[model samples]
Target chain A: MRRAGVVALNTFREAVRDRVLYNLVFFALLMMAAAVAVGQISIGIEQTVIVSLGLSAISLIGLLISVFIGVALVSKEMDKRTLHALLANPVRRWEFLLGKFAGLVLTLAVNTAAMALGLLLVMIYVKHSLERSDAVVLVAVYFILLKLALIVALALLFSCFTTPLLAILFTVGFYIVGLYVQELRNLPVEVMSPAMTAFTKGLSYLLPNFENFNVMAMAAHGRAVPGALILQNTVYTVVYCTIVLTAAAAVFSRRNLK
Target chain B: MPGLAIEIENLTKEYPFGFLHLKKKTSLEGLNMQVETGEVFGFIGPNGAGKSTTIKLLMRLIFPTAGSARILGKPISDVEMHRDIGYLPEQPYFYDYLTAAELLDYFARFHDLTAADRKERVERMLKKVGLETARKIQLRKYSKGMLQRVGLAQAILHDPKIVILDEPMSGLDPVGRREVRDIILELKREGKTVMFSTHILSDAEMLCDRVGVIVGGKLRGVGAPGTLVDMKTQGMEILFELRGTSNAPLLSKATRTGDCYRLQVAEEELYAAIDQLRAAGARILSVAQVKATLEEFFTNLVEADGTHTSAVEVSGK
Candidate 1:
């Protein structure tokens, strides 16, 4: 675990030096301010539009960083041939994989925090005074970060043996499936057979239910997010991340890093 | 652990190529050898001759298909044993964003060194590699030789007992190569074992206490460089300088090379040629034995049976 932290530190340093992360964070902030301008076009629902745009921008940019950086986490090292030097050390394959996972998670955490702060500033600029209920936006941003963490782990799992391009494709595909998988479990009788419903229910068990993490609608509309919902989503994200990361480590351990 | 620094027993590695893993290409085939403790061992082979593959296996970057290797008396799979050795891969790549100090410090942490120890060691390694001036500069801005120095610095940062270098001299000038040779010798003086691979036999002949020739994924020979090259000596060459030349049959093939007449005296005719040199009042400038070098042996070994890979990319690495 300590060795994993070393890899994590190095990964963070490399990502910080990269211009892409900064560029994405800058764009997220830009969109937050742009949200204010776009919100003025809608008079009565200005707050809704502003919050919606800010939260959506955070989710979009955060996942883009997560998916892209996560897929290249190992592949970039392999291409640079740095993995050879690392594996030769006291570090194991699993530790290295976990370290990369930890590092990217940390990066996403910092970037998300920055984007969230930006969203807050934009909110203050539009509203005359700070509202106590504005804290609801934090809840939504927290879910976005949790969702990005799971997406990062999924990207890592796909990256164990596949190319970065293919890993990105597969990770995106899984994200799309995860978002709508719960819908399959609750299909209407007229639109679905009993057997198909059973199959979709099984799939819901097998795949992550991303819908559980989407508090964006409630948060953006300035409605309170239930504490029960936050706790449930946190537990789900933890379980899903553990399973995905473990599977990634297993695949990486068996990999022949040619 | 006590007798040898490394031991390999019939190690083999093969990679599957075609769909369904139908076709397999052998990278290393039944390699067997041993390296004694505290000796500079040179692993000589052309590109893709399994030198890198063999090093990778010993380093546990990849597993062997059917054999076992022990490093410092521990099985290759023993993670704890990695603390006693260091490795540098061919054309190694490090994080270009890191400075020499930061890179060395990162590697030092893997050895469980403390904060102060890491700081001291990183500083010492930078000075040893002559990169102290550029310690704060990022790796991407360093020249190739500087990068090699950084690589070397990181490899030895933890002060491991054994150092494994795969083409350590790849991107260096002659002066840099001399510095590397000196560093290897210095490591030996410090009682550390060094194993390096290269196609350039001269470097091997100059620095290696013992050399192993790997061709076509198999070790063709392993012994002291002198003995290995001397065992195949075809004849001896005797050179002398004479103001005038009276043709002697033994000197029939003598050619004027600058101010000397070079003659290849047969093994049986060596004494007879010396007798003639004394009789003719010639200055016996030098009596040197002609023998095949590691390069010649390598070439002849590859020319036969067409086993080794093409030599085009060998020198590039």
Candidate 2:
């Protein structure tokens, strides 16, 4: 447990210093800026347009950062032979894996909060006021964090056996496929063969339901976010993240450090 | 009981290719060796000679196909046993964003240490490796030698009983090498067992109390460096400038027929021959007995093709 904390802290420091983190932050900021400019050229629902676009942009950038950095974490350590040093110590493989995930998650949390605050401030300035229920923005931010947690877990699983580039590609591809899983299931059964329907249904259940966590869009339009729905999405993200992280730990334990 | 720091009996590790491949390559074959408590053992080999392979096996970084290794009489894979070992790899890596102190602090948590104890140990180690001045600077700017020193510091921070260093001196300058040598000697002085792998034979000669040399996935030799050098083919090159207008002593030893001296000593007499020359009125100029270095010994063993055991014999009886 102590070893995991140490590893996590070191990983967090290493991740925060990466130039890629800054680039993502910059791009996320630019996205909000673009959303604000587009809102000015808008038809009536300018506040709704700006908030929805800004939140979506932040979430997308956060997802990208989490997957890209998490996938590279283990592979980069192996590439530089640092994993050998860590393994040589009185540390367990599971501890190392958990520590890496924790560190990446902590970094994502900080970046997500910064991005959220940036969008919230712009929203407040535009309306000369912020909505009372705008406080629910925290829930949307939390949901986005949960989603990134799942992405980090998936990226870590890929990193266990593959190169950084391949891991990143597979993780992002999984995210895109996972986002469209609902649409994939809604396709006509008559138009698709039995095997295709089964495979697509299996994929839908296997992949994370990112659409279920789309509270940010509803919140931006001032729509009510049901408490039960947030609870359900949180439970789903937790279970999914747990499974992926466990699989990553299992595979990493068997890898040869040398 | 004060068990051996490391013990391996008939340890073999085989790596099999996939279904498409026909042969399996055994990386370590029937390796047997033991390092007693408080002994400095050197592991030496050429590149791709299975040095790292053996270390990885010892650390349980990879599962062995067969055989077993014990550390302090416990199985190599025993998690609790690792608390007694400290390892410094060839190129020790640290998070570049952290300072020397932070890096050690991060590693210190692995062992059972209080917050106060960790802090004290981290400071002490930084001082020990001569990095106290740079303790606050980010590791990104550290030179290779500095990086190595910090690596050494982290390895020993927990004060492990057995220190395993793989190619620890590979990138050190002469002064840095000497400093590391002093640290190794200090560890030995503290009664800690120190094992390090190095291709530099001279360092092995200076540092190891016992050494095991491996080549082609087999242990070629295991003993004190001095003992191995003595057993290998080393001779005395005596330069005798005859004290003369006459080439009498030179010619007499040469059988008076040839320009070369017919040295008739047996292999054991080589040392005595040089002593006798110094005793005789011959040479008096320079009498130097050249001993085979560990490098030459290792080269001979690797190139000797498993059957030849020709010992270099001196010819002056």
Q: DockQ, in order, for the candidates?
A: 0.83, 0.65
lDDT of 2 at B253: 52
Q: In candidate 2, how many Å is residue B210 off?
A: 1.0
The residue pairs in collision within model 2 are B263-B315, B263-B316, B264-B315, B264-B316, B264-B317, B265-B315, B265-B316, B265-B317
lDDT of each: 0.85, 0.79
List model 1 lDDT by residue over B1-317, tens digit each: 44799999999988766669887677788999999999999999778788988998998887788899999889989988989998888887788998888888888889988899999989988888889999999888988789889889888888999999999889999988998899999999999999999988899999999999888788989999988887777788888987776666655678777668888867888888889876877778888878878788877777773666533233222
TM-score winner among the candidates?
1
Interface RMSD of 1: 0.9
- What is the TM-score of chain A, computed separately for every candidate? 0.93, 0.90
Candidate 1 collision pairs:
none
Show where candidate 1 strays beyond 4 Å.
A24-32, A35-39, A188-196, B241-248, B273-286, B310-317
For model 2, the superposed segments whose C-alpha errors exceed 4 Å read: A19-39, A193-196, B15-23, B233-239, B243-290, B305-317
Candidate 1 per-residue lDDT over residues A1-258, each given as its tens digit? 999998998888888998656755575557666765765677666667777878888888888988999999998887788898888789988899889989988988888888788778777766755688889999999999999999999999998889999999999998999999877777786777788878878987888788888887787778999999989889988998999899998888877776
